[model samples]
Target: MVLETITRRRMIGISAAAAGMALLPLYGRAALEAVTWQGEAMGAQASLVIHHPDRAKAQGLVAATVAEVRRLERIFSLYREDSDLTRLNRQGFLVAPPKELVDILQQSRKVWALTGGAFDPTVQPLWEAYSRHFSTPGASETGPSAKIVGERLGRVGLDRLVCSPERIELPVRGAALTLNGIAQGYVTDRVVELLKAGGIERSMVDMGESRAIGSAPGGRPWRVGISDPLHAETVLKVLEVEDRAVATSSPYGFRFDSEGKFSHIIDPRSGATPQRHASVTVAAGQATIADAFSTAFNLMDTATVATVIGNSEGLEAYLLSHEGKWRHIPARTPVLVSKAL
Candidate 1:
């Protein structure tokens, strides 16, 4: 679904989804001040916005959130040399794996099935092959040869991965996992949990992905802007969301070549670069679902994506075409409302 070659594709900026928050109503008698914190997590910029009357308490919450993010990064970060993921990829097996690692893998497996293998984490080798090819001088614009892709495909499959309470194993040699597509959302959700546990009812957690703990200040819905793939600076659409998570995936987010053909989002089933949409934005109750489905929906057709959304409650998508047209799943809904800019 999504690849995280730290040098090639880290936490993609394009998929960070929200442009900025709308103007907030000033705090009245509540005396709530919006406390903000910005930092880095899992190789991407991260931030938190909390509205609290007590700034000191909010700062403490921010500290706890940062600590939690660093803890998870030690497990999911591909850039961290000593991360559990790095050790597993280097050795092909992990003994007594962390419960968090196993839990995310299990969540990945569920989305892998829900999207019919579109949300795969075993596409790391494909990323390596393409990154190597593009790094060479005068590489072909057409991408890696079919033979090379086929060979890499042979080692890519979630079914080949074994997971249990005690250990996690990759049966196929060279098989690896990249949680770039899902881990950020997992982290965002976790931050929201921490903030909620700290008595924060209205806040926005942007830990690579974004999740609103509740409505914005003064009962207004949070506004999330979706940037145009052709023009990253242009916010093509805006979504009014409350107590929901939004994630976007764009083929133009990261390209191996200057022509913008090959992308960081790879179709694991065929080892092919996505050519379906300029971008696919998914909104769900959980940031994890929004993030994974945003990446997976790029590999699926409109009908298939629509069906998946139809079958699931509190799930919707907005697909932006290269032609600059927008397509919405379910056609109408109250969970998420969007206005084209």
Candidate 2:
């Protein structure tokens, strides 16, 4: 299974994944200006590209979008010392938590149930152990010992928290939360909402993942290139997206090992899923689900991938094996397609 590069381990030290985009100009039309913005948020590069008829209005909208993204960082970023997530980790409880935090936690619980615990936010402890173990000046090439991992694994599971509208509590001492796996996509969704609220439709939000708000200038689907996990500089497939989100997760994106064999995506159950895929890409209407499921799908086998995709209403996956072979759960995913050579 392909795993997300934004495992909780990423919050400790690993850099989050950065995505790429492509937009073509439409000939024989009015000036379909595409404005762009670039900056860093949640410890990685963020970009916004939009096509609009009114340049001034769209620029203002983009500015508002950047501010919105920064606001979300305060809610979800683990790097910030005062983020709600950081405060919860430090104090083990947060009373009167922000609504956004509560919303995300509720969604995480649903994903946890859907993926059979594979998409767990409580994997923070295990991620800490592995990330810290390998952060030493000259650490061992292996993962944390079975004993160390097992102790931390005891702390794994979202059920450790008592979540409610009044407050959320982590009863277990030292228990923490990590939304890295889904936060970026959540932020992208919010940005899309913000843009749409301002009358901007033809837009692309790339905050670690790509979300297409609407069709391109000429009513064509937005084209997104899926990078080769082992060699990110290359694009293995191009997906056409319209009012959908595209997310990719891989074992080789961020590795503690020099050979790029180990990614930080630890299976909260088994402690690890063998590196079996280059990456798994998911397309869905909600960026959060697309992000969370892509991470969890990396830990699943082919049969489970098929079952999960089939049962879900409008979700699809594109799997690229470690050996460079391509596979799809339904033999054909409706929202994503490979670009013909």
Candidate 3:
């Protein structure tokens, strides 16, 4: 089955997947306009919503956004089989990749190191192993299979991945990479840079949940509704953010029960679902860091998450535990609250 999850927190009214059309009202007069266009990317349905007042400016922003998406698709998409990432997977190493891909890989390695290996692209092999084993009868219910999978996951280490400025090589044959944790955020950062360069100041572009930028019109921060942890249709809180990126990592979005046991949000470190936190939302100055840290924090224990957020300079976080309480770190003191609150 195609696993689906909402990994970010941004409010663009939901539209039917067919034809990629959203039903939200488009602002026409306020020197700000919003439009949603859907296309296939990263092996899934991708949407782009650009909001700006100048029609010409908005069009340019959309063009730049599309170009950024296409560029990332070429570098990170595993579905293409011919993508740079896919080629590396098939060949065990790639020589002389595009500069953009090289840059992202280098950045990913840095994040991997910073997170103490909690966030890793090399966990693709572990995901495949768990998915295959979980699909078999009795395997999901048995602890033995899970133990076996976890043991095998020990081999999926970031240290096994070697990257130079010109090339990347995986030491193990089965090691694969998935940019799902950071690619969208990187794309979002690029789109924001393009919009700024094009002189369009206020806009929001969402690539799934990992990237969103800009604010609404009239000098107001873009208002986003966070989905209820218990119910996807309900809003638990509203956040007003501007010129920043927000990402939500939650197991509630995509989960499945096998023989009365629940599993979702696979921990790359353990090849199993993490049991500590129910959901985490991170807002950072950059989308790539925000996206990567959300997953990294999710895999971390409560104390580590607290330590990371407490010491982080520009990162603000909202976390919900499995016990149904909300906690925040590095309190902004007088926090901004939405009307719904």
Candidate 4:
């Protein structure tokens, strides 16, 4: 599953309006000023905005953060044939793998176990099957058959993966791993940490996943508009984020069918896209947790989603079910934006 970008990255580094749900860099100029940089990372466009009084200082920090992002992508990106992940998939194992690679694989294991395999990274074979099938001439909008999905499922178990600081291996040769579901959030976290370590307090990093290190310009809370799936241009709610991470997963973000029916987030357990929720937005102290859970929530029932979101600390979810019901975990009612006029 390629981590299709949730929204298009604008050429301009900043946005003045918060009218749309594309997570605009809507930090107005007030008591504070911001410096931003837009670049490509992890097969998608990435942007960074930092509030700083000194322009030169912020430029230096932005340069370092982008460099750090490129460094991490060498370890995680699957598009690069020379990347560690690609080498592992080609050779079936990687010896003396980088600790960062091992760390994320371990983290993915925890999420896989926590969500009862709803967040498996081992679903790449199934993705390949669907991509291959759907690209055929005169293909059906419907997905592949049960038999084809079943064959791919044999290589879809996270338990079949062996991950350690020194080595990572896939037990099945046909099994490949895609970090699309969670890597963006991890990259966001790392970039934010790099910025924070440099004594930069106010910032927002959107590396597919979004995280804010401090309040927006003028100390106002960062407002994230959650897009209504039913009405693509509508805002469902506004989540005020301060020093927190936010991620949204929508099946419609990437479609395999002509009519946009099948989603890219295929359930490893079912070998089909589950439509329990139209979209899931998770907010947490850590982007990694928010990233993984948002993907998992798309495959979960409402009750199961509530139970998990309620028990998890530092986590909040705004979910819209396929039936057009809004659900918020932990009973914390956020500000729901009125429909577009």
Candidate 4 lDDT trough over 10 residues, lowest sum? 12-21
Runs with alpha carbons beyond 4 Å of true place in candidate 3? 1-57, 137-140, 143-147, 210-214, 256-264, 331-341
Which of 2 and 4 is the better model by lDDT? Answer: 4
| Candidate 3 clash pair list | 8-209, 31-53, 32-52, 32-53, 33-52
Residues 231-336 of candidate 3: C-alpha lDDT, one tens digit per residue: 7777676667666677777766555554423444567776766656788777777778878887777788767777776665577777778887777654333334
lDDT for every model?
0.75, 0.71, 0.64, 0.73
Give the candidate number with the greatest lDDT: 1
What is the number of residue pairs that collide in model 3? Answer: 5
Residue clash pairs of candidate 4: none
- Residue pairs in candidate 1 whose N, alpha carbon or C atoms collide under 3 angstroms: none
Q: Best-fitting candidate, measured by TM-score? A: 1
Give candidate 4 regions above 4 Å deviation.
1-36, 49-56, 230-233, 331-341
- Candidate 1 global Cα RMSD: 6.4
lDDT of 4 by residue, 71-118 (tens): 888988888988888888888899999998888888898888878899
Show where candidate 2 strays beyond 4 Å: 1-36, 49-56, 137-139, 331-341
List, residue by residue over 168-248, the lDDT tens digit for candidate 1.
998698888899899989987887787777776665555666676566545566667777776666677777777888888
Q: Relative to the unseen true structure, what is the C-alpha lDDT of residue 62 in candidate 3, on a scale of 0 to 100?
A: 65
State the weakest 10-residue window (summed lDDT) of model 1: 1-10
